[model samples]
Target chain A: MKKNLKWAAIFGSVLLVCLGVIIFGQFSHGTTSAEIYVDGKLYKVIDDLERQKFQSLRVETEHGYNIICYELGKIWVSESDCANQTCKKYGKASLVGETIICAPHKLVIKIVGTDYDKADVTT
Target chain B: MRNNTTVQKIALIGVLTALSLGIYAVEAQIPVSNIGGIKLGLANVVTLCAMMFAGRLAACCVLGIRIVLAAAFYGTFVSFMFSLVGGVLACAVMCLLIGLFDRKQLWVVSVFGAIAHNTGQLIVAAVISGTGSVLSLAPYLAISAILTGILTGLTAQRLWFSPLKRFRITQTRDGK
Candidate 1:
């Protein structure tokens, strides 16, 4: 019985450590630009967000809509027409991999740029 | 050992569904975590126990009814989609693991099932949101799956030895 538990504990611990490393790596990689993807396709990129004082980008899709608000260092869903409001509840995030998702509309706001360019700088 | 008469199978599935739905109602009232998809998932105890006592088919019947009924009662279409994916994947994982684990290692099956459930939900969230970055939530979800899985697994294990014996619905080791 003790041996059985030992196996489960070992497997569980290994999984936990692997996941932890991924999360830590994401937070440590900083980016000021945020990209909005509508249904997995890139819609827009807000580059060098620090230069912008405040902005609200409205993304209206066939499924629903979400208003993504961005400022100096962070991005968030300020308002949404989705069912659960999960994106709004997610509040705000500024890290490189951070994302605000409105599932009902399939909208995603992800932090994905660097200090090199205006986060909105998309060619 | 349980009889496999038509009426008996129907009654077994019905009973399992009722018990799980009741458990679901109570669990719904309690919010264990602030995160949207994170919860103790106590109702899953009944589903797991059904798999052990009844059979995989019966357990699936119970789970399917519970998901549909719960959604009809209060859940939105989006929540319904999430539950369907999570519940089905979780059940499938348990069905596969049940054959491999020692009878006493039922907790292992439960833990794996819980993680599969969380993974299923995470995948749907990522797809619906349109980015893989939502995977940033993976580590947190995995950690929760382990803790809650252990608790629910241990609980199911205790019942397997205790009350489930009296309510046993099938003699067949259906998965094996």
Candidate 2:
């Protein structure tokens, strides 16, 4: 029993540490960029949408279409043809590691930054 | 062991299934402002309790039926697929770890089950979204799983030895 508790404690601490790193990474500032992917392919990359101030792109895919709205430092799916409006409800995310996914539409909007390697940070 | 008949086992599984479905509905109404696809998974408590008091097969029966009924009541086909994936993966991990862990370490098993559930859901999300970016949320999902798993695990651990023995669905090994 004591050994079980010890194991639980060890696993719990490891999860906590990983969570802390993710949170810290989320808060830290880095070069502002965003990536949009559809059906596992890169659809668009906004290197300086922050400078563009405001823009909207209507993306059409085999699943459906989504109107991706970009602001100073955030991106979102303003409109979607999916049954559930979860993607639209996600609204906007400006953080370095934030994301909005339209599952029904197979659309992904992710906030990327130059400071971190996207593939390395996540499993 | 005399009370652990087939009829009693079926009734117990049915009751637990209903309870889990009810929990799922109530949890859906609770607004949780967190990352996408994260849930408290309160219904899993019933699954865990069923697994401990009854057996893995009984637990699987309850979980499978509960998820199906719950999805039919308030979820779409896509949502149902996600639930099926998460629920099956979680139960599989929990049942597999039962023999691995000695003592009353149900919590550890529960935590691993939660992690498995989240991983399954994450994979679904990644596939649906068509990007590996959804994997970025893994850490947050892991954290949520740990917290919620501890809650459900402790509840099951307590209920395992509670007065609900009268409804004993499985024969006790040590004749409690």
Candidate 3:
């Protein structure tokens, strides 16, 4: 029984450390761009090049459609045709490496880290 | 175990399966704030309890039936696939842990089981969506697993002393 407690404590500490890393990583990864993928392929990149304060795109295909909206540094699915609406429920994602995935539609919208946040805008 | 007649074994398995399915149904309705796909995994209590009291095969039977029936009743084909992979992985990990650790350490088994289940689901999600970004969500899922696993494991431990414990099928043949 004592040995079990010791193991539990060790596992608990490891999990706590992992949680700390994930939470810290989520908040700190400076995101300057968002990437959208459909059916495992890259579809679009949203950055300063778009020049819109707020923009919405209707991603459509034979499977379905999702209306993705983005502003400044954050992105989210404003509308979708999927039954569960998980994408919409995921709300806004702004942190670097954060993602909103719609499994039914095979769509993934992710906020990606970028070192060239400005040079990309110029080119 | 050989102590339990085939008829008794069948009856116990049926009851546990039904209970697990019912718990799963109830669990689905309770939403986790912010996280869409995350669940408390309360139904794991039944699986853990079965593994401890009944035999491994009986626990596997209960887990299998619960996954298949739940998916058939309330899930899509894709969801069923996720459940099958996750449930099988979780059960396998739990079974292995149960053998390695003392019976009093069931919570450890439950914790690892939950982590295995989440990993399986995350892999399936990544494959289906074709995004490695899904892997980023692992830490959150792991946190949930630790809490939920402890809860379900303690619940099972509490249940081990209930009148229902009589259904335990002890190994008599080879003491395996």
Candidate 4:
């Protein structure tokens, strides 16, 4: 049973990857509103027009980290002071599938759309 | 050599707890790569080392203490639970695998631990979000886990072999 579970996990993992790729490929483009949050608080809301300009917006939070959003066409963390910077270099968030995260402050900026809203975000 | 006394054990656990907290704080302060929740997971090195040098029970104690203290320091109990569950499960599985193998495959165990850690966290995230779709991130998390695991495991291996080599040799010799 343990052996079976391991194999199942491997196969399930592969299947999930294929599914994610398919879903990502399918919804890769569209004009959508972008939302940003800092420390679980709503910080910025960018519409399709603002998203196109792809300019930089700096969000100063109560926490020590300063979130710099660059490239309006897609939302990406251009700069951040957090230790990992994993969220800062994510480049830009395009499509409904992308997200930028700063784990220390428990902050997450994701592209939420109707499909994602129905599928995941909403409990 | 004699076994560590209670005070020594407590002091060691305290030191590891502090180390893990320091790593966690430092990780939060610097921005390295922005891949959505990807972290260096430096604390795992200490946890893995504790397992090898001290014992599985000792490692568990250190890991548990570290998670609890770190969570309290951060003031996020919910997320702490996620970390604790994920981290403990991963460490236990890795230790078990390593014990079973009886080989110098620290990197393999590290990778397994990391993947397991991510899997545990993903499970919590999915449950919290009330959607199975969050499972979509599993592959990405797995890839990151494998990379970080190797890095952390290598560090642990060096730390274990360098200063503590004599102690390890003695322990194995005495056992036989």
Best by DockQ: 3
Q: Which stretches of candidate 3 lie over 4 Å from their true place?
A: A48-56, A69-75, A88-95, A116-123, B1-4, B172-176
lDDT of each: 0.78, 0.79, 0.80, 0.66
- Fnat of every candidate, listed in order: 0.40, 0.44, 0.50, 0.15
After the best TM-score superposition of candidate 3, give how far the Cα of residue B58 lies from its true spot, in angstroms: 1.1
Over the stretch B1-176, how does candidate 4's per-residue lDDT look in tens digits? Answer: 23534455566666766787788778766655444467779989888877776667777888887787777776465567579779877977887887864435676688789888988887765554344444545556766787788789879888876966443323443443
Higher-ranked by DockQ: 2 or 3:
3
> Candidate 1 vs candidate 3: which has greater TM-score?
3
| Stretches > 4 Å off in candidate 2 | A27-29, A48-58, A67-79, A88-92, A116-123, B1-4, B172-176
A1-123: candidate 1 lDDT, tens digit per residue? 896869677767867795677566555543567888888889998877656688898889888778888888878888888876667776677756556667788887777646334323543
Relative to the real complex, the DockQ score for model 3 comes to: 0.48
Clashes of each: 7, 0, 0, 21
DockQ, Cα level, model 2: 0.42
Please give, for residues B6-82, the per-residue lDDT of candidate 3 as tens digits. 66778889998999999999977764435535677889999998887777899999999999899888887777878
Which whole-number lDDT from 0 to 100 does residue B11 have in model 2? 84
lDDT by residue (A57-109, candidate 4, tens digit) is: 76766555655554655677666765534456655556454555555445566
Q: What's candidate 1's DockQ score?
A: 0.34
Task: Please rank every candidate by lDDT, starting with the best.
Answer: 3, 2, 1, 4
The candidate scoring highest on lDDT is: 3
The interface root-mean-square deviation of each model, in the order shown, is: 3.4, 2.6, 2.4, 6.2
lDDT of 2 at B157: 77
lDDT of 4 at B116: 88
Model 4, which residues run further than 4 Å from truth?
A: A1-73, A76-92, A99-123, B1-11, B167-176
Worst 10 residues of 3 chain B by lDDT: B29-38
